[model samples]
Target: MEYRIEKDLLGEIKVPKEAYYGIHTVRACNNFPVSGLRTHPALIRAIARVKQAAALANMSAGLLDRRVGDAICRAAEEVAGGGLADQFIVDPFQGGAGTSTNMNVNEVIANRAIELLGGQKGDYRLVHPLEHVNLSQSTNDVYPTALRVAAIGMVLELSDCLAGLQAAFQEKEAEFAGILKVGRTEMQDAVPVTLGQEFSAFAEGIARDRWRLYKVEERLRQVNLGGTAVGTGLNADPKYIYAVIEELRAITGYGLARAENTVDLTQNADVFVEVSGLLKAAAVNLSKIAGDLRLLSSGPLGGLAELKLPQVQPGSSIMPGKVNPVIPEMVTQVAFQVMGNDQVIAMAAAAGQLELNAFMPLIAHNLLQSLELLINAVNIFSEKCVKGIKADEERCRRWLEESHSFITALTPHLGYDRAAELVKKAMAEKRLLREVIIESGLFTAGELELIFTPGELTRPGVAGAKLLEKKG
Candidate 1:
């Protein structure tokens, strides 16, 4: 089948009807399968923004007729609503300077617009892809601009997830307020602390992640739209830049502004790297929390056994009463993937040599995949692991009471030499440190009781209250 050529301000380009089909067009079309990663939701959303901006620009410029503008706007609205996002299956890791992905979205929006106009597929004869749909944009500008908009959208979702997770930890903080366990340092018991303090620390880590995501979103809000074709604005009208940015901000509801230096915007992808790094930090925090949960829930028979994870599924094929903390395990795996994806993003960002970053497809794939995974992982961790977590209060108290390391807290009052002697004797005899302290003549039984009370040791104010109230 013969195909027609379409010319833009750049030059004439031939796209075959058989090979270059509409958005709904799919075949054995596997030639440009570079990254094999599909275009991200952020990229798709950005494409919608591009379409919206083009329509608005044309309407203002008196270039596009109202019928064409309205058709493009309506189609763009559908794309923005994510109706046509699934059709954008171009591999994110493709070559052709992201032209394939760009053209893929263009084709989809154009065909959808054509249908809206009561026209047939490949009916760019009425609403040309370059002339009407793409308008005064190039892949260089549009792809990156869409990327910025999409990143902002994703960051917003991540923000919500982080907030939810943070809140979940905060709730756990309240639930475990009085539960005391032996704190570990260098993997050895150190002192007594309320489990609430641990949960509060987890919440603080998530809050830091939330702050980093917000900062990354601020950088992503600066887009490269007006930097048409190598940041020169060669063929684009002077007013196209500001007008498109305004329209995109309205369309996306993000605080998007034009890049201060369009040349730098076109060439640099460091913002993506910064965002990816923040995601890595967030993933690390997640993995740390997961590690804590797994350790806390390690054994009902052998391990620490200080806390009980909510049992969601059976743990073993052979064991009858077995349960596992699968949610934290799954979150740990997600964190691992996020960390690896960050490496990919770092490499892609660094591979940008001179003019422009050619690895945008990879950058977009890794970054978006990280964001999506983290959001889902955070949701799962909050709902399955954190919200359902219950303090094993009796077990916690037993561990705290049994731990010889609580002697460290008494050392301040008993002197380090006496405390060390008591610990050595307790370890040798396998007796409770409280019992050893009382028997060793370092303190009387009543004095040992006063100093070794779990309530006073874990809750600072309790010790103060005992001293102030002259407890019997």
Candidate 2:
């Protein structure tokens, strides 16, 4: 293996001759080995876009030569297009408020631009990482801006996934629209409801999440790119400060705007906290819906067998023919992980001090991770679980027939006291409520049959009251 000497403030080190990264990135690679996980590719692409935008902004403001800006733009575009993702070797969990990641991008772009300009690698005279590529920007601003871009992209993807999942639920609702099942409260039977209504509730919950995720993009669109180090636009040309964001908007095609209060934006990480809170809300809803599906599909014989989830794999190594709700179980675990990541984001956001948040790396890492996880989880859940779910009509009907809760339908016809006595007697004898009603002689068989029909029992109002009066 051949090596080239690259020098930094610390000293000189040997770098791979073919590598696009430089001394600073190599130092970061050696220094942080905490997570074994590298920075996300989406985030790296965002950083490249920021650098390209800055170079154009500088050229427009006369801060950079046209040739230098052109070379930098070409190199940054290569990075943005995912040509040099392998060059970003820094871990996601690092100190210095993501300075390592910022420097990694700078070094990669500088070396690539040097190559483009017909200059040798590590030749700062042609393309200096800090003086040329990373001019008029600080990690404090660049890192968070890139984070916002990456997060917003992921949020859009998650919204699409959620919408698909919601559609799957709606289809299931239509398929099971007339299948009657006993609703439960406190794990006990309460009343009759159509399986379709239950699926519609699931669809509504996911629809709400999709709307909330779309709104999150609005909050994330405000960035502090031109704020420089401490959000005062220090050392940054006024024209460049305004021009950079426009360049960024053109590059990203997002409604990204510079924050009005640059200093406040630099200091406070509340926007990230709000995004994390929204993610937590979605996670909570997903976990709850997954749990309900698991319960409804619990057992084939011993549990609530109203639902039969699609079986993609064989369950139980020792026990024969024991299928499990593995997909929903997997989704529930993902929700748990997203909830945990949200907590990490909150703590890191709150840990920011006066000038800038030193925990930007942590926040960026966890936020992007949660978004990716949710996207995959929702898509998988829709395809593997919700869309393939089957209704056990026989089991559901059996539960409805045995439930004493249906006696509530008789209250308006037979009066509350009489209904309560019938329910009590049914439970005491461990018999169906209709049997007790028959023996009580409260009404003729025809009237009882009319009251106990599926339409009369499930819907509101006494459709059988006229029958009762005619028979009496």
Candidate 3:
């Protein structure tokens, strides 16, 4: 519990003598106690990678002391490896467009690098945080670049999780491919469809989501790494500016490129808005599929009872024998949150004034949170719900057979007006259409039988017509 004094333009402050973070980070901790949430570890790792790339670039340009640069590189490597995660204490909701986060990384790397040089943590004479650690950078450029890097990693993870979910749905589609169920529109039975077909649609929606997630990565990979201080490159050396981006590409193994219009990249946060919109679209699809699963698996008795989601936990404490679709419910909640986060990102993106978006901390926090939540939700939904779902074959068959929508199959033969009248009469009388059709004497029983087979009814091409042609 020892301390040392570190001063900035504001004033001097006592920093823990052993803390890798120095006065600036301490100031940030005191200033922004807003969220009580720490910056994401992914973002911290990305910032450290930026610092590592900057150190290497500085050395390559002969702008830094070789021993000092080497030490800084080693410190940054450790931080990027997540060795010093506990030392990053700034809240994600801070002001100054993530300057607090940027400085927090700078101070931590500078102090640790000083230790590697056999100097005390607070010894600025050996390694100054601002002069050495923060060379050729500004929060305006570095923070957003780091955010992009972090987001790229997160998006990839979510994409993988979504792919898993899509595959789970496809597996279920195959499992239930033969189970005939009634399709509905406006809550009324319209026609017959296979349970497998419903799940195939779900998988297709998620496949589109996976494709969208992949496409947005290219947008994020265009970064303003060399555009220090409002994209003018400012006091940064030209050689360092050009070389740092290449070093960053090597460090991250991402296809990162410096922005073609650095100033526009610095001033506008619209790309994050675009990414959030795409996430919102995916959330919509997830929510819709979850809602459908909930409806299809509603009750063992009174509901559709066509699907039985894996019971993960007891649905109620007092309602005996209750098992809820908690996995899909959880995914629905995640979708709600993602939709809300998209709004936050939109407002934050629009709130940017001239040279920089002062709202980046909020944008970064919400975007990363959305990604993490979606990844977890998708993974759990696949494992706990979709993978274990079972179709009620008898229930699906009964509903499909009982529905008056079977009149659809006869429309081509009996004509639309006659089929509509037959459907109305059968539904009103609570009579099976097969019995009604047989009693009505519109077609022979053999022809009706051929037309009403599950494959002939649900699939294209009329088996009854083919039967008639062969008979002739």
Candidate 4:
């Protein structure tokens, strides 16, 4: 391939003649090959947005020529619109507190802007990356600001995805409103509850998560965009500092505000930690519900057999006609990964020192990863799993009839001691509890029917008292 020589502090390096990225990006690509994963697409676009805003702010403050600023704006807009995705080749994992990423972005924009102004690529005389494109910014401010912007977009998308999951649960609740099932606690049968009530609980939990994500966006919106090197606005014009955030808000269309205490925002990575914790919370809820789905749909013949998940694929190679709850399993695994990502985010956030967090790259990488993971996971769970779940009415009824837990309902009618005795007799004889109660001559079959009807059993109040009193 044809190449151009570019000079930096480390002397000269060859750059691809046709490539939009320059020497800094080339160095970053060679220096860090840790994760095969590239900078997240959202983060790439966010960095472009930050560059565009900075150019505009500089032009407005009269520190930049309008002609240079316009060319930079056009090039940055192209990047923001995903024009040169191949140019951002640096891996997500790297040292230097994200300086590598920041410089990589600056060089790409500079070369692209040079090309736009009818100059050759790598011609810094036309558009210098550091001197023009990154005029009044530092990696300390630029990286974190872009991280917040990218995170906000993903958080909002994930929140909406959770709404889809919540709606799926609500649909199931309505579909199963009258289907009674035996609730379980600690792997033992508990009492009667409508399948709908159980789904309603799942919906409520997700609703809470959706709300939390929505509220957390506010915290992310507070950025340290104009803080320059150390959040003290060092070496940056006051007018440019004030105007940059406004430009950023306009460019990204997010309600972004410059942090009131930019120094505090710059040095601290706790907001990302808070966001990661919420993601973990959502993961916990999802893993729990997915586990429940797996349990409820455990077996067709040998297990609880209380639920029937949709069969999307073959379950086994040796076993005939075998089906599995694969979707819930997928969600559970994704949750586990997100849980791990949360821990990584926590450690990276806490590892930050004074005046700036040197671990922003780690925080940024894992934070965006968790958001993307959850968004896809939740959408899949809603569309592929929760929406397709089917309760086994026959199995539910059979389990309910056999469970000794229903004895609590009959206690008011039979007294506690008598109820315990009836359970023991039923268990010893290997007979149904209702049959043993009938054999005891405690009440007629008609009275037991009133006590055992699903509508009565799932609701509050003594099982047969109201109906029997009316009969008397």
Candidate 5:
């Protein structure tokens, strides 16, 4: 490919003639090739929006020429609208605390702007990247603000996915309302609970996750877009600072506000930690739910066998007719990944130095990945797994009757000692609690049927007490 020479402070470098990215991006590619992953598309669009807003704000402040601002805004819009996506080539892991990312965007926008103005791509004379496109902006302000924007968008998407997942569980809850199953604590049968009740708990967890994820937007909406360098608004004018956020709000349609204390917003990375912590909490819930699904669906012949997940594929190469709970397993793995990303985000946020966090790139990368992964995983789980689950009503009934734990529910009617003695007798005889209770002749099968109704089985506190009261 034909190449063009671009000069920076570190001398001349050759860039592809057709490439919008220039010297800084090339240097970044060379310096940080650790992860071949490029910056997230959401973040790239967010940065373009920041650049567009800065142009409009600077032009309003009379600091940028109208012609230059117009050209830059047009080019920035192209990038923001999803054009020139391949031009953002910098790796997610880079030095200078996202300066490489900022310059990559700047160079691409400047070159594209130059072309729009009927000038050659390398003609910085028409649209200089740093002098015109990035006027009144700093990496410190631009990068973090863009991260906030992208994160808010991702969080909204994740909330929607969570809502869908919750609905899936709600549907299953209604479907399995009549399935009486044995509940276990510490791998031992504890009590009888309807399969619907178990699914209702899953739905409740996802509902909580959705609400918590939605609230993160409130924290992310406050940003330091014009607090150039160190958040003191040192190089950026006050008018530009105020106008920039307004332009950003209008462009992105987010309820964004400039932080009252830009320095605090700039220097501290605690918000990212808080966001990651919330993500970790969501991950925890997802992991637990996934594990429970796996456990419930564990065996067609040898395990709990209480649930049957949709068989999307064959499970084993060696075993015949084997199918697995692959979707919940997938959800479990994604949860692990999100949880790991949270740790990375937490540590990166805490590793920032004074005046400016030098680890913003690391934090942004992990946080964004976590959001994207969760959005996709939760949606897939809802669509493919939760929606397709089938409860084995017969199996549920058998397990509930076989376990002595069901005797606990009869304790209010039978005295505690009698219940305990009956449990031992049932175990010793290898008979079901229902059989032993029937033999005792304290109540008929018809009375036991009324006592163990679906609502009565799972409802909290003294479930069958009224049966004995009526008998008295």
Candidate 6:
């Protein structure tokens, strides 16, 4: 069968019509049949760094033809400027250690360069994907380099989103400062705490996770791009490594350094695994926060009744006026998926055996997917949940005032035996602990009030309720 020819800007490159069935390539030919997702902004930036590194490496080694080097650099600029970025499409998921992805970029750049010179795709008889576009590079080196660049970009955005979430919780902290609620352990009321303190704990957890992610970002800055195929730099000049590292640093504004042990770099992808693990930890924390929100907002009149979440959507088709903590629920689901993806990454990293890690395609897919989901989840949680949360102040106050658990605070003053007896009587008779204490003649009304100031029980102070505060 004669293959139908599609002319690329380069000239006439013939892709087996059947081979273009991959998601990215097919989508590029279909939806963006006219244009694509505009060459992922992160990818465009990465390719620019790749070209810059390639040019610097070639120049330092006296192997660069000035004319071809100039053309490659120009093409890189055009791609970076969003020209032809739409032409490259290889599924973010693929095998071949991202060779398909690398080739997609190479083809687009080469084709665009050919157009600049009045040629066509596959007219690469002059400027070729392997010859000029990929000089001194292998998928082993280039693929990981691009992944690092893209991961760094994602980390930056994720960090910003996390900061926004932290700020949202912090604001809620101040807003709910005066509202007290029952604190629970093992799903049972254990003590008194202000709603503000609860939000602050959530914010602190996120802050710690954000710092961990930032630390992981540093690992991505040390790329193994100059390692070439087997990490021996077999076909590359010795000086190329240093030069490429310098150029990449310049292009990316990241503190990119060459791997000290390129051979180990080629053999182990534990770095990616570590990053995914950190992300999993963050996701777990997000899940915990979401779980708390769901539990606190479990029912408006039937459950804990301590806090209220913002209503983002209707909770039921059959039960009108029911609002669910859907935002947190979605965040919880994203967290679970991210956690599972991290396990997949760990297994893939462990599966790396001989000289080359062949599981990078899966690693990249998992990492990218985790980042996208986490970023979106953080945005939704902050916007729809944290920022919109309201304390059920009256309900919280009533729970605190009516709780028999508060009698525990009086133990230090009345002796444990007396306090226990009073608590038992209050629970048996279904009377308020305060009323039981006053009626039993354990304490006068003034002394009872002094011993049971809810604020002091919630947060310790030096005055009226010191013993109660200590017990709490």
Candidate 4 at residue 151, lDDT? Answer: 95
For candidate 2, the per-residue lDDT at 8 reads: 86
Residue 219 in candidate 3 has what lDDT?
91
Global Cα lDDT for candidate 3: 0.90
TM-score of every model? 0.91, 0.96, 0.97, 0.97, 0.98, 0.88
**Mind giving the per-residue lDDT tens digits that candidate 6 earns over 1-472?**
4343545454544464333112234434433233222334565457666875787678767777766666777778776666655456655545566666666777666656666676654566766767777778888888777778888988878988999999999999989887767777898767777888999999999998888888889998877777889788878777777788887788778888888888888878888888888899999999999999888887788987677888777889999998888898899999999999999989888988798878777787788789989999999889878887878888887887777667666666677888888878888999888888788776678776665554666655533455445545
**Candidates 3 and 6: which is better by lDDT?**
3
Q: Write the per-residue lDDT of candidate 4 for residues 17-114, one digit (tens) a residue.
A: 98888888888889898878898888988999999999999999999999999999999999899988998898888888988888878888998899
Q: lDDT for model 1, please.
A: 0.80
Number of backbone-clashing residue pairs for each candidate, in the order shown: 1, 0, 0, 0, 0, 6
All candidates in order of TM-score, best leading: 5, 4, 3, 2, 1, 6
In model 6, which runs have C-alpha deviations exceeding 4 angstroms?
1-13, 16-48, 78-86, 460-472
Worst 10 residues of 1 by lDDT: 20-29
lDDT of 3 by residue, 1-472 (tens): 9999988899999999899998989999999898789998889999999999998999999988989999999999999999888999999989999999999999999999999999999998888888888888898899999999999999988889999999999999898887777999998998878888899999999999999998899999999987988998888888998899999999999999999889999999999999999999999999999999999998889999899888878889899998888898899999999999999999999999999999999999999999999999999989888999998999988887788767887777779999888878887898988888888988778887777666886777754778767766
- Compared with the true structure, all predictions reach lDDT values of 0.80, 0.90, 0.90, 0.90, 0.91, 0.76
Model 5 stretches astray by more than 4 angstroms: none
Per-candidate Cα RMSD to the true structure, in Å, reads 3.6, 1.7, 1.5, 1.3, 1.2, 4.8
Minimal lDDT window, size 10, model 3: 462-471
Off by over 4 Å in 1: 1-28, 34-37, 453-455, 458-472
Tens digits of per-residue lDDT for model 2 on 340-365?
Answer: 99899889988999899999998888
lDDT for model 6: 0.76
> In model 5, what is the error at residue 379, expressed in angstroms?
0.6
